[model samples]
Target: MTFSLVARDSGTGAFGIVISSSSPAVASRCAHARAGVGVVASQNVTNPALGTLVLDALAGELDAEAALKAVLAQEKFPDYRQLTVVDANGSTAVHSGPNSLGVHTHLEGEAAVAAGNLLADESVIAELLGGYAGSTAKAFEDRLLDGLRAALAAGGEAGPVHSAGMLVVEDVPWPVTDLRVDHSDDPIGELAALWALWQPQKNDYRVRGVDPTRAPSYGVPGDQ
Candidate 1:
């Protein structure tokens, strides 16, 4: 019911993940990531714990493959879950539930991982992976979102997608930015619109570069 892509920006060293699901608030449960740490997307019979466990393993000095392997090794029902891991060094790996509706596969590349269950077609995942691999930008967040957007454009999850999210963290206390569109009839469109709200400038004010807590100084020193 969920599809996701996780990748590290080759140029900025930033890591991020983008996700969408037919389930409401899917992101709150399906995605987990830490900047400079690692990224994990656990869904379709999600272990939930795997999300944090994978992050800890990578952050605690384990490689991506090792971290993912350890998680798979201990799963009592690995055949029912799908997961992706991307370590601090940009290494990527993925595993899909063997029982996943007959069309799941992992697509791994330079600094990214794309995987899904109950997809419209395997080509959707391939298209997403290709988008990530071909990205030339410096922001992993953007790349991840672009991958998901591409997948959505190609037709997502087998069914309708209601919730979507983009998550990225830094050394900062919280995620640099965490955006979610819950229960939207058109989640992808909602997500794109949300990104535009955070885009650099509009109305002579900018949401970019300013702290979320800072009030924007819109007009001028002398206003009507």
Candidate 2:
């Protein structure tokens, strides 16, 4: 009961994953990415460990397809999982297991790949892939949001998607963007709004971590 996309930003070499699902906290278990490595999404009776395996292989310098193949080869029940990977170079790969739940399909485009199961229709993944391809957003996060919105517009999951999330990793070891809407009637929209509100502080959070001297002070009352 999930749909997701993994993409690499050509301009900045960032990796991002955007996902939504009928289940709650999908991102917590399905989406994974690492700075300067790659992005991976694992669903359809997800084994969560598979996501980490893909990222680990990518960090070892494997290409998108190679990483997925290596990880999937070890899966005891590969036929029950759906996975997608995008490497730092923008190469993409996807796997939809034979036993994936409900109507499931996937599509790939330059630097991006999308997959969905238990979808409203086959058109859902195509719309998400096309939307990301057509987006002009300078930021990977915005582009991902565009893709998720497109999926929703095209009749997202078979039921209401209660959780939505965006994950992005830039040059830093930590995620520059990691936002989730655990339970919402409109999780995708809520995720977008949260991104907007978080945009200005994205860099600030990083600065606080690596260079507190240059970090802006928190405006909250306790800092005085």
Candidate 3:
């Protein structure tokens, strides 16, 4: 029901995840990333907790493979979940439970990993990784968006995807880009548009968080 890509930007030390699914609000549950840490996508049975577990382990100095193994060691239903992780060093790990939903597959690429359950075919995962590889020169968020678009073109989910999300973390503790299109007819396109709109203001939002005194006006009603 879901297809996702987790990747690291070698040029910028950024981490990001792009996901789309037949399920509503898929990103809220399946994608997770922390600045200077790693990225994780937990799908299939969709245990949001696993995303945190993996990130926490990575934050605790575990490599991607070690972090995933640590989480699976405690995961009671490992056979029912599909997981992928990419660490700050661009190392990756993935696990697909034997009981994962139909036609599940996962693959690894340079500084990236991808997984999907109930997908149209293996082409979906291939295109996802391929897109990331081809678009390394693009902005981190745009590279992810291109991967999601390629997933759609390759075949996408077995069913119509209702939600899409992109999460990207850069030098800050917070996400540089976090966009979700829950229950949209065309979630990927909606997410792409949101990224475009957020591009100019991305830094400003971070500024507001890190230093309100240096932040600019909100450009809304009360500003004089």
Give the residue spans of candidate 2 off by over 4 A.
none
Per residue, candidate 1 scores C-alpha lDDT tens digits across 3-25 of 88888776766677888888898
User: Which residue window of length 10 is worst by lDDT in model 3?
Assistant: 131-140
Tell me the TM-score of each prediction against the true structure: 0.86, 0.98, 0.97
Clashes of 3: 0
- Per-residue error for 69 in candidate 1, Å, reads 1.4
Tens-digit lDDT track for model 2 on 1-224? 99999898888998899999999999999999999888999998999999999989998989999999999988999999999999888898999999999999999899899999999999999999888888998777888889999999999999889999999999999998999999998899899999999998998999998998888988999884
Model 1 TM-score on a 0 to 1 scale: 0.86
lDDT of 3 by residue, 1-224 (tens): 99999999998999999999998999999989999999999999989999999999999999999999999999999999999999989999999999999999999999999889999998899999898788754688888888889999999998899999999899998898999999999999999999989998998999999999999888999874
Clashes of each: 1, 0, 0
Which residue pairs come into collision in candidate 1?
120-158
Q: Assess the local accuracy of residue 191 in candidate 3 as a C-alpha lDDT between 0 and 100.
A: 92
TM-score of 3: 0.97
Clashing pairs in 3: none
lDDT of 1 at 218: 53
Give the distance in Å from residue 176's predicted Cα in candidate 1 to where it truly belongs.
0.8
